[model samples]
Structures are given as C-alpha cells and as structure tokens.
Target: MSPKQRILELREQIRYHNYRYYVLDDPEISDAEFDRLMQELKALEAEHPELITPDSPTQTVGSSILEPPFTPVPHPTRMYSLGNAFSQQDIAEFEASIARFLGREGPFAYVLEYKIDGLSVNLVYEEGVLVRGLTRGDGVVGEDVTPNLLAIPDFPRRLPEAWDLEVRGEVYLPLQTFLELNARLEEEGEVPFKNPRNAAAGSLRQKDPKISARRGLRGLFYGVGRPETLGVRTQQALLERLAELGFAVEPHHRLVSGVEGVEAGYRAMLEQRRALPFEADGITVKLNELSLWDELGYTAKTPRFAIAYKFPAEERPTRVRQVVFQVGRTGRVTPVAELEPILLEGSTVSRVTLHNESYVQELGLRVGDTVLVHKAGGVIPEVLRVLTEAPRGQTPVVWPSRCPECASELVLSGKIHLCPNPLCPAKAFEAIRHYASRRAMDIQGLGEKLIEQLLASGKVRDAADLYQLKKEDLVPLERMGEKSAQNLLNQIEASKNRGLERLLFALGIPQVGESTARALARRFGHLDRILEASVEELDAVPDIAEATASAIHQALSRPEMRRFIERLRAAGMRFEAREKQKSQALEGLTFVLTGELSLPREEVARWLEAHGARVASSVSRKTHYVVAGAGAGSKLAKAQELGIPVLDEQGLRALLREKVGQEP
Candidate 1:
C-alpha cells in the first residue's frame, strides 16, 4: 500500500485498539503489537510529513496551545445545572411540577445516568478534531483545559467522520487510583487529597499536562450539547450515540418510566454504588424527550427538565483529639481537626477542615469534642455538628493571632485570616514556585527542592534572579550534576521567550490570571504600553474589572516593580504580545447562529472566521446579523427586537456572495 493509505489503515487500527482497551476494557491486541503499529505510522509520517493531519494520533500529544491562564470560553449553548431531588417525595413533586407545566400528565419517559461525583468538562470538536476542553465554570463560561484533556489516553481526539460536535462528561479518578495517588502524595511529603473527586479536579487543573496524563483520569461522556443538530431526540439515544462515537458513556445508564422507576433505579444504584469503580453521589433523572426540554424551559440556575436525586450520605461519629492550624500557599490559615481515626466508607477519616473561623466558632469545636463526620457528596470529609455543646477541654478552637511560619501578626480579610507579610517564608516559596511553574516560565529540572535550596543559599532572592543563575552555581547545589545543571540552564534560557502574557501572570498580580493576562497582553501588546496606560485603559480590556484594573495599574506603576521588570528584561525575556494569525477582513461584524442550517453551524462559522467575521452565541444590539434556520427560535425574535438583520440559509449565502464573492 502507498504511505498515505498505510498511514490511514494504521490510524484506524490504533483507534479500534484504543477504544477496545480504554472504553470496552477489552484489548484485541497485545501491547507490543499496538506499539509496533504506532511506531510504523510515526516512521511513515516522518518520511512523508505532508500527509500528516491535525487529528492524527501523533498530533494528540501536547497539541494544545500552552497559554498559562486557561482562557474562559463561553459555551455555544448554556450548560444548565440539574435541579436536585433528595427524597421520594421530592421526586414525586418534580414529576408533579412537570405535569403542572405540561397541563396534562401521563408517564413521561426518563433517563437515569449515574451522577459521577467528579469535575464536569466540555469537549468541543470541529471537523472531527478535538479543539477545546473546558471546565464548567458557572455554567456559562468555562476555563479552557484543552491540553489536559488531550492527555487522556481514551479521549476521542478524532471522530470517525468530519463532524462538528460538543459533548460533556464528568472527569473522574477511580477509587483505587485515588488511593494510590494519595499514598504517593503522602510519600512525597505533600498533603493528601481528601477524596477521589478532589483528586480528579486537582489533577485536571494542573498547569502541566504531564501531571494530568499520569493521573489515570477517565471520563463518562453522555450529553450532546446540540442534540437537535445531531437528530438525537432523546437522552437514551444520545448516550447510545456517544458510545457509538467511541466516547465512553456510563454503561449502566437506564431508560425507565415515572418517579417510581427513578426511585427504584436510585435504590439499585445506591446498593451497588460502593462496588462501582468510581465515586457516585447521585443519579441524574433527565426528561428523555429533547422537544419537551425546550418546551419546559429553565429556571435562572437549573434545568426544569432534569433533576439530580442525591444518595443519602454515610455519616459516622468521631472525636476531635486535637485541633491545629495550617498555612496555605496564599497564607490562608485553615483550622484542621486531628480526629481519633474512624472508618467511614472504607477509608480512615483522621482529619477534616473547619473551613474558616466562622465555621469553627459555629460548630463550637474544641480540642476534645464528639462530632458527626461524613464524606461530603461522598468525597471530602466534613463536620456535621458537635455532639457535645460545651467545651470538653481547656484547649479551645480559636483563630491564631500570629502567622505560624513567619510569626507575623494575622489580620482578618473578610472571615479568613491573612498574613500581610510579603516576605513570609511560606508565601515566598509558593510565589517562586508559581513563577517557575510548568504553565509559567516552565523551568524544567528546577524542582521544589532546588527552589528551596536557591532561596536558602541566597543565590536567587526572587523569580527574576533565576535568569541570572550560572551553570557553575547550580553544579554546587545538592543532586545537581554537570549534565543536569546544563539542562537546567538551557531550560531557563528557553523560558525567556514565554512572552509578556505569561510574564504578567507569573508576576502574581492579584486577580490577574491566565485569561486576564492574555487579555492584557492582547490589548496592550507590550509591558511598556500597559505601564503607560491608565487604570481606565486597563479596565477597558475584557474581563478586567475596575478594581482589578486599579490593582494592575498600581503593581505596574510602582518604582520597585518597574525595576523588577527591567531586571527581567535585562535577562533577555520577551515583553511583547504574540497575537494569533487570523483573517481580519470582517473583524467588526458579529453573527449569531440559531436553529438548524443546511450545513453545520461550525462549517459556516469557520468559513466566516477565515474571512474575518465573528460568530457570537447570543443575540444583542451588537449583533450584525442573526442567522435563522427553518426552526429559528427566541434568538431571532431578540435580534429582530434589537433591530439586528435576520438571515436565512439562502439569505446568508447571498450576503456571503455579496461580501466575499463566494458561496458559504
């Protein structure tokens, strides 16, 4: 076979094996055989580079743009959180509410999916290639974590066909993996994660893709973001379609009838919940019909068509042997109770966080007190209430007046204690660590120990001084061999080109995260420009509020801070924006997509974007045109009300022809 044909065959074979191994838990080939196929594909691609595609298996690894602050992406359609149901009566009330809304009641079909106690992530695909992975941040905007998602071994990186799709699922860590991870953390002298769900979230949110890749994270994708576009009329069919597309759906998802069936399904799942591989705190009951979902509409925060029926928590009585305070990286002093170890849900619960001073005072928690402990949502250990009201010991639960590490006096920042000392050893270490983090400077071979050592030896007082280090200086440090020191130097030297966006974020500006830094860099183009701009100018950037802008202006305008910037610049670091290449032909125009069109909305959007037009999700006065399909809904009405022009598929085509002299 020709190289291209052979490459395609190899990719198909590898995808099938991947699906079998990861999704079906059944492998059709040995590890060696699979590796051989991959090796052969790589060899062919190396010889014939022109034949490579974005969705090729070789392209899946670290394919995401390594921007430090994950950009906040708005969902094409709103991701509504399900309303909760706790009891049989609540389920009955839910059914009744649906009946009341419909004005007539019968047996409406329901789909029950295991509400995996994990982080919800949205995966977006364009032309069969996975483009974005996002966290469900407030249901409307999600933080982009595409790199982390691409690291998942089983990710449906390339669909079987060139299709536009968005699917959502819970990213989870198995109970066994969670335990192993926690044990590894403890061995490494790091704080253990409270539970699997937290572990999953922490793993997925890491700046380094390697961390997420090693976490053994799994996903159970079920819901299609635009089921109407896919012609999937029911939740059951959607789940099946997701499975067919090589995306794993929760295997036990069921289709049933009535509140009684939901209750029964919940009971069945609850009975087998502990035995299941991952954490399950609840089951989601979705109204199976997609048409009815729109008809029912939504509340401000939750969907009217679906409700999560939570399983009752398993609580146990445990005594607080001692209460102690621990300082976080941000200098928040959290009170932790050292409990007399008790077994709850197969794990020993020895410590639980009091959350804040208010919670400690509310619980009236003391050194020696009986309290109810339960895994919150079958995940983090939480205190329910104190069984003993009165103080049982002389050592009372009180907020510390002084910082534990630096001995600086603590002050209240809202309800939490804050250490005002910028020079606090704990905070200093964390700051340096954050600067050298994988998503920031990405100084490889500069581990936490090396950072601590550099700080102790007074060789590098701040993160900027890192660029001033010589290979000879690192050679003297413990565990730093000649080769290792050279590699470290090379890595540090390479970090100079990380760009102004990462530098802004690395400076640890308050409220200036990845997205905020990106906006600032994209807006100002250079650090000097940002420093010259007023707070009003800073606030003009997207997502940067007035207060945040003031903070940024204050930080950048400081004489000491300007000197720091100069030092970084002297070290040959870049301070300029690297804007992405795009067509700016119709840059000022925005179009809102609604209803179904002749072709996929993504296809039209891509074409428009290539020619410099923007595709927006919502209808507003700013919208240039509303693309209405046969079933155009409220967006079209809103656009009309706002005096925005409406365009059907044919009208859109005519406009494209007139504007760009080409067919959409």
Candidate 2:
C-alpha cells in the first residue's frame, strides 16, 4: 500500500483502538501490537508531514519543538470553585446560610456529585457538535485544547441529537487506565507519572493532538455551561438532560429538596469516594433552582449558587511488616514502611512512606509494630503512630550505613542520610528508571519489572544507555516479542527529544520534584548552566534549601554525571527557560479549602497560585480566605472566629471577579 493510504489506515485503526480501550474499556489487540501500529503511523506521518492531521495519534506529545507559552481565554461563564464543610456543625451552618440566602426557607434542596480529582475542562458544543475544549484557566479564561479534547473517548465528538449546548465537566484518567499508562511509560525506560491527576492534566495539555489521543483521555460532563440554551429550569433538569444525551453524568447525583437532604447527600458521597474508580477530593452541592442560580449569579471568578462539601480525612491502623530504604537518584535515602495489608479508604494498604530516618524515630516505628495509617488529602498514605502495647522485643531496622547497591559508605546531611558514591548501582538504576519515567521522557512500555530485567541482563547501565538500546538487544529478553521490543526502542528514541524540565526532573535530583524541575528549567534554561552552578548559587533560588543545594552541587561534581549530561546533550536533548508567570491578586493570601468545589482543589490551588495565593492543608491564623462548601466543619467556625473572610462559592467568585476587573 502507498504510504499515504497506509497512514490513513493506521490512523483509523488507532482511533478505533482508542475508542475501544478508552471509551468501551475493551481491546482486541495486545498492548505491544497497539504500540507497533501507533509507531508505524507516527513514522509514516513524519515522512509525509502533510499527512499529519490534527486527529493523528502522533500529535499528542505536542507539535513544534517549542511554542509560545499558552494563552488563557476568558470563559463564557465564570467557573466558581466550591466551599467546603467538614463537620456536622459546619453542615448545619451551610444549611443556615442557604436558608438566609433564599429567605424564609427552613430547608433547601441540593445536588451532590463526587468531586473528581482531575483537571477541569469546559466543552463548548455548538449545535450538537463539540467545537471547543478548554482548561478552567483562571476560572474566567482557559487554554484552548480543542484537538486534545477530541481525543478523549467519553468527550462526545458529536453531541446527541436535540442536545446542542455548552457544558462543563472533568477530564480525568481512570485509576486503572492511569496505572496502565504509567506502566507502559516505565517499561520503555521512562519516568512514571507522579499521580493520576497530574498524568491526566499533562496528557490533556499536550500540544500534539496525537499524543493526547494516545493517552486515552476521558471526560464526564457534569454542569451546563449555558443553561438557558438547554431549556432546563433547574439544575436537576439540566443533569437529567445531560443523562438523556448519553453524557457520563454523576450516577449518584440526587436532588434533596431541603438542607437536611442536601447534607445527607453530601455525607453519602463522601463515604463512597473511596469506592469510586476516580479520585474525589470532595462533594459538590448546587442550589436546585436554575432561576435561583441566575439570581445568585456569579462573582468575577465563581458562582455563588453552589458549594462543595469536603470529606474529613479518616485515619486507619496497620502494622509495619518491615522497613525498606530506597536510594533516590540524588542518593538521599527515604525510609518506606512495608505494612501488613489492611484495607484503608478504597484500596488495600500495604505500604507507607516514613519520609526519613527522623520521621521513623519520631513515630517510634519498628518492624512488626502496629501503626495508624491515614491519607493526607486522600492521596498520600502516612503512618500516624506506633502502638506501644504491640511488643518491644523486635529489633529496630538499622538505617543503612552504606549504599545497598555499591556498598558505598553513607554520609550524614541535615534531616537525611545520603549515599555519597556517585557510582552506586542502586542509585544509578533508580536514577535511570526515574529519568525514563512517564513524567520525564514518557517512554511507553517501560516499567519497574522491565527495568529490573534490563538491569539484571546488563542491557542498560544508566539513563544515557537507554538511548543506545537496540531492538535486537530487547527481543532476546524474556517475554519480549519482536513488536514489543521495537515499540520500546521507538519510545526511547522519542524520549531523547523531550523538553529540558522533564529531563531535569527525570534526572532525579535530590529535593527536585516536577515543580522544582520546572522552576530550575525556567531559571537556568539549560543542563549545562545548572551543572555549572555552585552550592550557594543553587541555594539562591527560592524554595531551594541548603541541603538540596549541597546535593545538587555534589551530583553535578561527579565525572560520570557530567559525562551522562554531555552524552544526552550530544544526542539532541533541548533545554529552554520557562517564563515566570505569577498573579498578584492572591499574593500573601492563604486559602483554607473546606469542602468540595466545582473544580478539583488542585486545579483551584493552581489557579490561586498563578494569581499569587497559597493553599494551606489546615486552618491557621495566617489563612486569608476560608472557602466553606456544603459540609464544612471546624475550619468554617475557626475562620469566622479568626475574622478571616469566609466565602461561599458565590462570594469566592466575587473576589476573583473583583481582582480580574470583571463585574460580579
């Protein structure tokens, strides 16, 4: 077949696969086979640039080596975040607030929805055809990601007949899909994504439609962007219409006629969050009457009509089976606790991070000791306390004095011990593994198991060695088919072209997370520049501590490290400075999120941060705004007592609007 025809066929096949896998949750072909088809399509498109359509699967990684920073567009309606309620009293106060707002209301009805912990996106459907897709940029304006939106399976390319309207919903990666995607990225010698939310957001924002398409993005329509066009008189009616139109409406959404029912609904959803496939940070409650919604109107940034009830974090108990120490890329040792399997939240818990030796000692944790496990923000699992009555004879696991991989004598730094050996095998392997992870190079088909296999087989010695891999070297490995091997090789090749920030983060520098990496990339702009910085120079950057500076300085000082960086640069790695984007309105402001919001808290935090605000985990005197949603508890009262400005959804919207110079 001609290359043009082949490309078309390949595109069709991959699109079909995306629908089957992402939308239908079924697949006919093996993952390896699927990867091969995508690789073929990408190659064909590369050879014939004119054939590279917006819908092609190869466009997801982004197009153009470097594009201008994303421009934000104003949303048609101000996207309001939710206020949170934590305790029963908080719920009662929310009800009272509703009654006061409506006037002469003993009870008010509310609609409850699981606050999905994913990126918030707005979908504009013009006459039943999906026309525009945008991120909830600054609530008012968002980044245009229309092509990427089309790739999401659940985001209907064409709305159902008789349903031509704009709507808002979350674009999230399901837990299973997220895990699989990360797994694939790991197998190809790439960094694994940090979390599902980050993965989903990063995937959706890809400049390349093809890359977005390949990641299997999905959307769930939750709110009417333009309710008047829908001919719906109430929020309930709008949801019903959304359900009729085959959108993935929240199945548990129920309209409670009074405040009592609203509170109950919020409680029910909070309890069910752990059971849901998608992560829900809180529950959303909207006033039922669509007219009331209009009357309540919106502040510059959010609607006054709805509030989100956040679930209080619950702590559960588990036993520590053993303590395992992991050497990170920069050689800092993190102590991890292997817990006796106990069901917590939604999944079975088997492990928790002790953070460091100091943390372990602070908790008085030892192997065979029962400890309380609680998720902070329903995401990170942490050990709360060790039960003293459990027993005392067990020997405490010794903090490793030497590198587990190369037996290099460990060094003491502030708050952490480190493996000073630049050539520690374990450190090298982990560094290489992290460098190749999804958030880094996003090499498909790479995973921990495969990394281990590669290491054991002596096929890959370091991160730089990944780019040098050949299909022949992989095909001979156990369980690796010819197609799988080639797919991995292709992914590795593609990773060589990833941006500087990703490469920096992938390098697994001590205390350098994705955010830090981005910051560094923005500051230094290149690997060579960062390598040349001294400890003091590194510490001069905001948020970079002395220990982090020392670690970075040490890492850069290594001959092998310098060689690896040079090799990567020689192989076409690119680096560029990121622009420092900041918002002054939220400067010095601390927001205490109580319940749920229309958008995820992270998205809201990002919005606030961009505008110069900080999101604190708990209520404190320093907090400036306490956002109280449906089921807010102690925080709300605390805020009131502290004389901090308390904002319901509408109030918060007003604040944002005022800041942005928009009328509330």
Candidate 3:
C-alpha cells in the first residue's frame, strides 16, 4: 500500500482499538501492538503534516493555542437543571405536582439514576461524527469545550450508526482519580479542590486539552435533548440508544412507578454510594415518557418532570483546638480552625477555613467550642455550627494584624485582609511557582523544592529574577547536577517565547484569569498597550467588564508592579503578542468549512482566526463565506440557498495568498 493508503488504514485500526480499550473496557491488541500502530501513524503524520485530520488521534494531545476563548455554541434544546427534593414529603409533593399537571392521579412511570456530582455537558453529533461538546452555560448558550471533551477516553468521537443528534451527560472524575489529583495538588503546595464535582468542572473547563486528558475525566450519558428524533419514547430507551451508539451510558438506571419505587431507588443509591468508584450525592428521578414531558413543562430554571432526591447531610461534632491564620498566594489571609482530629466521609479532618473574621464572629466560635463538621457535598470538609451556647472561659478566635511569614502589616481589601508586600517570601515563592507553572511558562525542571531553594538562597526574588539565574546558582543547590542545572536553565530560557497571554496570566494580575488575559492580548495585541489602556478601553473588549477593567488598570498602576514590568522588559522576554495577532485581511468576515479538505479544517481555522475572521461551526445567514470541498453536504446546500459565497481549496489558498500570506 502507498503511504497515504497505509496511513488511513493505520488510523482506522488505532481508532477501533481506542474504542475497545477505552469505551468497551476490553482490548483486542497488546499495549506494545497499540503503541507500534500509534508510533507509525505519528511518524507518517510528522512526514506529511497536510494529511492530518481534525479527528486524528494525534490531535487529542491538544491544540497549541494559549488561552483561546471557547467559542459559544447555542444548544439545540435548553439543557435545564433539575429541581431538588430533600425529603420523602418533597418527593411525594413532586409526584403530586406532576400528577396535577397531567390532570390525572396515582402512579407515573419514572427512571431513577445516580446523580453523579459533576459538570453537565451537551454533545452534538452530526452524521455519527462528534462535532461539538459544550458546557451548559445559562441553559441557552454554552462554551464549546470540544477539544477538552475529545480528550476524554470514553467520549465517542464517532457513533455506531450515521445519525445526527444531541445527548446530555455528566462529566466526572472517578473517586480514585479525584484523590490522586488532590494528592498531587497538596504535594505541589496548591489548594486541593473541595470535591470531585469541583475538580471535574475545573478540569473540563481547562484551557489546555492535554491537562484535561491527564486528569482522567470520565462521562456517562443519561438522556437525549430530542428523544423523538432518535425514536426513543422513554428515558430508559434513551439510555439504551446511547449505549447502542457506543456511548458510556450511566449504569443501573432502573425504571419504577410512583413515588414509593422512586424512594426505594434513592435509598438503594444512597446505600451503594460509598462503594461506587465515583461520588453520588443523590438520585435523579425523572418522568420516563417523552410524550408527557411537554405537558409537564418547566420552571424558569429547572424542569418540572424531574427532581434530584438528595441524600441526608452528613455532620458530626468536633472541637476547635485553635484558630490559625494561613496566607495564600494572592496574599489574602484566611483564618482556619485547627480542630481536634475527627473522621468525616472516609477522611480525617483537622483543619477547615473560617473564611473570614465575620464567619468566626457569626458562629460565636471559641477555642473550646464543639462544632458540627461534614464534607460539604462529600468533597470539602467544613464547620456547620457551634453546639455550645456559652463560652465557658474559652478564648475567642483572634484575627491577626500582620502577615504570619514576613510580618508585613495587613490591609483590608474589600472583605478580606491582604499583605501588600510583593517581596514577602511566601508571595514571591508563589509568584515564581505560578510563572513556571505548566499553564504559564512551563519551565519543566523548576519544581517547588528548586523554587524554595532559589528564594531562600536569594538567587531569585520574583518572576523576572528567574531569567537571571545562572547554572552556578542552581548547581550549588542540593540534588542539582551539572546536566540537570543546564536543562533547567535551558527550560527557563525557552519560556521567553510562551507569548503575551501566558505572560499576562503569569504576572498574577488580580481578577485576570487565562481567558481574560487572552481577551486583553487579542484586543491590545501587545503587553505595553494593555498596561496603558484606560478602563473604558479595557472594558470595550468582549467579555471584559467595568470591574475587571478597573482592576487591571489599578493593578498596573502600582509602583511595585511597574518596577516588576521594567525588570521583565530588561530580561529580554517577549512583550508583544506572539500568537493570533489580529489583522484586517478578513475583517468583518465569517467563514464556515464543510467536507473533505486538502488541509485539515483546524489549519484553515487557525489561518482565519489569525486574520481577524470568525470560523463558525454551522452555516448561517451571518456566514459570509463557506469553504466548500469535495463531498460537501447539508452545509454546502444551505450556504448556496442563502446566497453565501462558496470557495474551493484552490480559491481559499489564493485568497490567503492575496490577504494574510504565510504570516503564521
């Protein structure tokens, strides 16, 4: 076979194996055989980059874009949240309410499934091929998290039959994966996520797909947005259809009639919750019939046909030994109650954040007070209430007036106390760590120990000082070898090209996250311009608000921050936007691609985005251009009907040559 033909065959084989191993939990080939096939495909793709497809396995490693905004994609049908039922009375009332709405009485068919505490996402498939996976933002519109969703091993990139549909599911990290992730976070001196739900939500929304992939995220489809289109009449049938289409459907969803059966299912789920490999805080009870769903209708927020029956809250008494102050990377001081060790949800809890002085004062807490503690949502351990009414001569929880590490005077910023000292050892270390983080500069060898050593030895005081460190400075540190020191230095030097968005985020600007940084970088196209931008100008950028703009303006205006920027500038780091700098070439234009292309559609997308053009997924009247290729389908016909301009591969390339050229 020719190289192209062989490459196609290898891709098919690898995809089939991926299905077997990840989705089916069975493997036809050994790991070595799989590795060999993957290696061969990678080698071929490396040699012939133009042959790479968007759905290719290699693409799952992640896109190289630093902090690109997830394109907002509207859901075909609204993905509504479920109403909560805390007690048996509430469940009965919900049943009665549904019955009353139907203008009938007695039993109603229902399906009960474990309510997996995780992020809800909608997956859109066109002709059996996965196209978009989105977060349920505002029920109407959602951030397109296709790349991160694709990173999930069990998420089917393609279905069994050639069908177009949308399915909703919970994307969660398994209990084991959550524990491991939390352990890693603790080891890195970073705060652990409160629960698996938070971890899963955080991981799914990660800017980098590779990082999401490493988190071992999993999914379980529960229902379809449009069941009639899929010829499914009941929730149970929808689950079966999802399974038939090679989706990882939620297991053990039982069909029952009336509130009693639903209650039984909920109880069973509660009993089995701890033994399960994932967190289940409740059982979601839904009316099974698709026909009656419309009649049941919905509240403004939640669906009327379904109710989440939550398990009873778990709380136990524990005494506060003392209230201690902890300093975070942001220099915000938090009061934590060092409790007498007590067990809660399979973990020992000795410390819980008091949140602020107001929280402590509200609780009327003292050192000797007994308080109810539990894992809030079976994830974060938190103090519930004080049992004792009287103090009994116990000391009141004291608030500190100065920083615990550097003894710098604390200032109240809004509701919280903050240390303004940039050179404070704790804050400096955190700043350097954040700068070298995988999401930032990604200096691989500068782990926490090396950073602490660099700080303690006075080799580095801030992020800019990191670039100034020589091999001699690192070599003297414990466990630093000649080769290791050189590698570390090389990594640090290589970080200079990480681009302006990453740099902005690394600078630790208050209220500016990775997405906000990207917005600023894309707007101003340079770090210097952003620093000088007026609040009104900053607020003019899409998604940037007045408050965020004010924060950005105020932060850059600080003398310490100004000095830091100068140091960074003197270090020869990139101060200009290096990626996706907007050009007027395709200004006010929007393009949509369809069918087989000579180059990957992603490659075309990158080019369009770089030239100030939007690349939409579906064809609409707003779409100015439709890049049609061989075997173009519905999108092509729609574009033609709407009188949108159509361009072939040759035409697109010629246009590129005339416009943006080979800039990227």
TM-score of each: 0.49, 0.47, 0.56
RMSD, one per candidate, in order = 20.3, 22.7, 18.3
Q: What TM-score should be assigned to candidate 1?
A: 0.49
For model 1, how does the per-residue alpha-carbon lDDT over 1-664 read when each residue is reduced to its tens digit? 8889999999888777755543233344433345567768878999999998877765542112223255678876767666566799989999999999999895788999899977788899898888889877646677778878888875788988777888989899988899778644432223456557668878887765767998899998878788875788889988888888888888898888998898888889887786789988789999999999888998655678898887776778878998888886655677899999999877899999886787788777778888888875455688877877545655787677999987877755445565544456666776678778887778888889998899999898777788889988889999999999999999999888988878887776555666678667766778889889999988866456786787667656656567778888898998886642133455568888889998999878767755656666666566899999988866787787778899888998888778777776
Ranking by TM-score: 3, 1, 2
- In angstroms, how far off is 182's CA in candidate 1? 16
The lDDT of model 2 is 0.70
Give the per-residue lDDT of model 3 (tens digit) for 1-664: 8889989999889878755543232344433346568778978989998898876765542112223255667888887767567788989999999878889996999999988877778999898899889877646777788878989987888877787888899899898888788645532323456567678878887765767988999999888787887888888888898898778877878999898998888877777777777777788998889888878787655688998887777677878888889887667778899988997777889999876676778778888888878775566677767887534327877788989978877755445566656666668877788788898789998999988898889888888898888888989899999999999999988888889988988777766766677767766888888878899988876556787787678777777778888888888888777665467577667889888997888877867766767677667678888999899986798788889999988888888788877433
Alpha carbon lDDT at 315, candidate 1:
76
Count of backbone clashes, every candidate in sequence: 1, 54, 0
lDDT of each: 0.76, 0.70, 0.77
Clashing pairs in 3: none
Model 2 over residues 229-348: C-alpha lDDT tens digits?
A: 878888888888887877778787777866678767776777766667776777787877888776676543345677666665566766777888887655667788888787766778
lDDT of model 3 at residue 128? 80
Task: Tell me, by TM-score, which candidate is best.
Answer: 3
Error of 2 at 370 (Å): 13
By TM-score, how accurate is candidate 2?
Answer: 0.47
Write down the lDDT that model 3 would get. Answer: 0.77
Consecutive 10-residue window with the lowest summed lDDT within model 3: 59-68
